[model samples]
Target: MAARRITQETFDAVVQENVDEFGLDPAEALAEAVEQFESQGVDLTNIVKAVQSGASEDAKDNQTHTVLQILESLRGHVGTANVDGMPADLKRFTEQCKLGFAQRYLAAQKDAYPTILACCRKVDGEKASLLAALDALSSLTDGQPDLLDAGGREFLMGILREHPDDPAVTVLAVRAVRHCCVKHEQNRQDLVKAGVLPLLTATVSRYSAQPELLCEACAALRVMTFDDDIRVPFGQAHDHAKMIVLENSGLKVLIEAAKAHPDNTSVLSELCGTLSRLAVRNEFCQDIVDLGGLTFMMSLLADSLDHQDLVKQVLSALRAMAGNDDVKDAIVSAGGAELIVMAMNRHIGNAHVCEHGCASLSVLALRKPNNCRVIADSGGLLVALQAMKAHPKALNVQKQACMVLRNLVSRTQELCPVILELGAEPLIRQALASHQDCGDLAQAALRDLGCEVELRELWTGKKGSLTQ
Candidate 1:
């Protein structure tokens, strides 16, 4: 049988029934009625005009709900429909409703925050409602974190604590925490006070097989660890914030998540990012090596040439881990050195890749003369020179490149003439003049070239200033 045509009277009756019998809010009842009418192939223009006119007292009392109803209707009309072919009037109405709802929602957040928190607190057995509320809160709080006050933070934490076994609720709750804590120091401190780190670790460990939950948990941990305010003074705790994560067994859980989902680039990226941050400390550097992090990072670099971001992160972690001679040699044994040089030459214009690549080479060169010889034979020096000339403004690249040259020339004298012949003097001088941090290292490299007389003249612009 053909669907019955829904007239204005039929629509109004459904709305009245919903409001009188079910106690549905007037706007919500109207939205439901509109959904039913659309299902029956009724013309929506009449309902749209009626809602927009604001003629009814109920509509006037709940303007936000009315706007939300229209927004939902507009969304339904456009759902799975080719937007490029949408009617002009319908498209215009949809855009207008969306903008209006956004303005109203932002304006109402000051009053809505506490109400949302209260709703969250009362969601005991209503998992669907709880998920809906959390999703809305996540959208509402994006780039508007101040709306999540201390109480709001507490409510989110409570959800995580109360629904520890529910993957859906845990994922949503962790997502909310991630959004709220990113770039917000006070919120991060609040989460720390709530002992969210251990909770995150436990969630990650418990839900390793659940990729969605693992992704969210890893994202939350990534943001929490990246906050600068959480970092302790250098010698006081030496990567104190990362130390907290390590203490909570965060690395172990992250590695397991990565291993569990080897095909998941997102999980791997976040996992690599967290490891890169933690590897800044020497103690965690060894921990990463022990956890097979070096091999994992090398595999990411070798296998996933398409993922530049992941490769960059992997290089960063390697740069940090290479601070240790043993790990440095391990990177070489794992073919990590060749991969670094390949990434540098491939992404020559990328300042970050060049900087970390050179930094890693510099670390590998230190105290290991044979590694310096290997880098030079692999055309690593040429790549460093190209990086220096390509990105003259990148101070770290210039510094690390100069350090690599300095170490390579100091250990292997035959390479000195080759470096000077490659127009090394001018690049070194340019680096010396432009970057104060690079001057000492660049100057030392110039000295290692056995050009003390030329260096004195370059420094004084006159002859006979050398001290024999």
Candidate 2:
């Protein structure tokens, strides 16, 4: 066949012809197949057939070579075709190809990564094969880390090193490095030392646009930082690892994902869960507030009333966000205090919601003198006081209410008087007296209100009754 036109069929036929007539080198045949697959879009099924046909006649010694050639061809197709169409029976074929070629390439090259790196680089800018290639690479790495040597390793890193901003590569590298770190502590440090934190952080900060990527990158970062060898490094990199998950991007994606898929309770719950962790960090708490995370988080709480667990998660996120003064103020400014009180009053029958809501209100009350008044003025102090008696059977609810009283009494002595005036002392003392099991929390509350001249006498009166 004269020069076959540069399409898929012609490319495959041309490669086959060369392999048949000239006994073309296996590598060259594979390279030709890759070009054809790229141009003609040959399915994996077809490649399997072609490889089998060629291998059927190979001598025992050359069977491995033929199989390796087939793998090389598939590897080159990494991100091109949706391998989903490939038959399951072909899995053996694919795996054999990966092991045979990758092992030989690694051995002969002795750390040479140019070829593999070139393949990965091809994946870099090609949208069609980016995910496909990454998926293949991930599978190839399942249990074999020795598949590439130092040169190959460095080359792969270089592909990432240069285009650190590309989301696809950045995401893939983050995943690969994390995988390597799981087995090798040194890999975690190497990635950190290689500046993966900034890359991960940047990806979070800018790529919130891609939720899957955002989730994956965050997950990888969480893993890396959890490892002792790299936790300190990751922490030192970003002001003590304080803002690990509370960045603009993460919050944005979570909020957007919740809004985009309201019916997906599991996904929304997961988002709220991530926010809860980030919200607890002082460094990130303010960032969450600054980004108006409070309002979106509160809305999630309201929208999830039917989902008790999700409501609790959203409430926990709210509590974490409001743990500090600035964040408390943000919540108050965003009308979160009012919204929280509404949720609390409406969901009092919900034990989980009641527990977290009361506990969170207590956290906000103790923030500082200035913020305590805002909390009390929002009817928070009274609602919590009532909730104590209404849900007295709820051990956690009672404990949280006591804690809120402790905070309020300590922060705003003036408010301490109002707490006492509203029969607060009676409710708190009742819980304190009746529940010896909660003595620690009760005593803390009693201690805070001790100096309140009016409330001191009340605790004293209840002290005798506490034993009864």
Candidate 3:
């Protein structure tokens, strides 16, 4: 296609009648028409005049779609690939294109969901699609959340990775990654490796008082740390994992986030959970202790209401901390058993939470059967029994509860007969009724009771009641 002179008549036709055909801005319509005209050996001067003459409120407004299309067209045009590649003339046009799209997108933010969606689809499906252009437009505006996607994410990350310390792009990339990387461990790790973690850490420490960014940073950190397969890069040579948290500054940031966002239950819960795992080292535990995290944990458990996940996380952390006799005593003194019993009863619908709650209970029951008795007295026995009534349907819960009951009996010895006398067998019957595992647990419990035959008969749906 030879560059031909675009006649003024054709250019003006495109600009004036854009709404009739393309429904786009006049400058953008004229630019695209001019590109086509130039490709066909048309004069460029007439095209420029048509574009400039047609730039009006309505033509500008209509040009938005055309502008987006131009950006899309520019994506593969090597001249605008990166900041370094941008020629001045092309850069000016790109900036103008971005401004046009931004203006239109903002005005129609609610209605522009479809346009952004289209941009994401193109970028993800095609390797060289205009993600950077769409992202730039997205960054300048708010309420265009659909722009956050794998393609949008990769594009932003690419920019940030290329320009490591550019705070503006880095900040946008971090913010974008936080909202988009929740479910993908590899993506999260990529962001971390791209120096995102350090950037986020700096933000947290610099704006130590910014609760929202701190919360997001903590969430990203929690996700990264929890990926069992991906290990944090150690800053020191002593031990990779140990160095990742201990010798380096990362752990301090986490501790500060926990202390910084005490009112943020979600942040505290995740922080405590991560800290509990990190507390395998005595030094880490001491750091946690020095930071007053243990007290925060107990208080979160006691005071934070209606947060089942937080409660469960705190309980798990407490369970980790329970190795310390003082911690165990503190838990018992803080009504840990009672709180757990409530969690158990309240989350009967969620098997995992119930399982963890019961695991925590089993931990406490093993410590002091009197606490188990407290649990038993608090309708906990009833809850566990009811849980078993469904049996193999929720085998994990039953297995955990069985463990708890076994722990209770072993510790108290006095509760075994009461457990049986209180009709726990009926639930065992329901449990075994589902599968062989239930039969095994029922058999083991009976063996523990020194009444295998009688218990076996009861488990098989016998008419005789333990109380009767």
Name the regions of candidate 2 deviating beyond 4 angstroms.
Answer: 1-190, 205-209, 221-290, 295-314, 345-356, 367-401, 413-439, 449-468
Which candidate ranks first by TM-score, i.e. highest?
1
* Model 2 TM-score relative to the real fold: 0.48
- Listed in order, each prediction's TM-score against the native is 0.68, 0.48, 0.54
lDDT by residue (tens digit), candidate 3, 1-468: 644554444566666576458787756776677566667666563223434322455564444333334443444343332433222323333354345433334323333333433443344333223334334334433323333445555565565455444444444445555544544555555555555555555655654565555555555545455433324343222232253465446667667767777677766766666665555554555556556666667677767757877877876776666555555555677777777777766666777667777677776677675676777777666677665654347777777777777777776777778888877665665565666675666656555554543443334456776555
Q: What is the lDDT of residue 22 in candidate 3?
A: 76
- Write model 2 residue lDDT over 26-112, tens digit each, in one string: 567767676656565444332332332344555523443334454555454444654442233134333543554333332233322
lDDT of 1 by residue, 255-366 (tens): 7778887777777877777677666666677787788777788888888766667777777778778887788888888887788889888889888888988988888888
For each candidate, the alpha-carbon lDDT, in order, equals 0.72, 0.60, 0.56
Model 2 residue 380 lDDT?
A: 83
Highest lDDT scorer: 1
Which pairs clash in model 1?
A: none
Superpose all Cα atoms of candidate 1 onto the true structure and report the RMSD in Å to 1 decimal.
14.6
Task: Assess candidate 3 and give its TM-score to the true structure.
Answer: 0.54
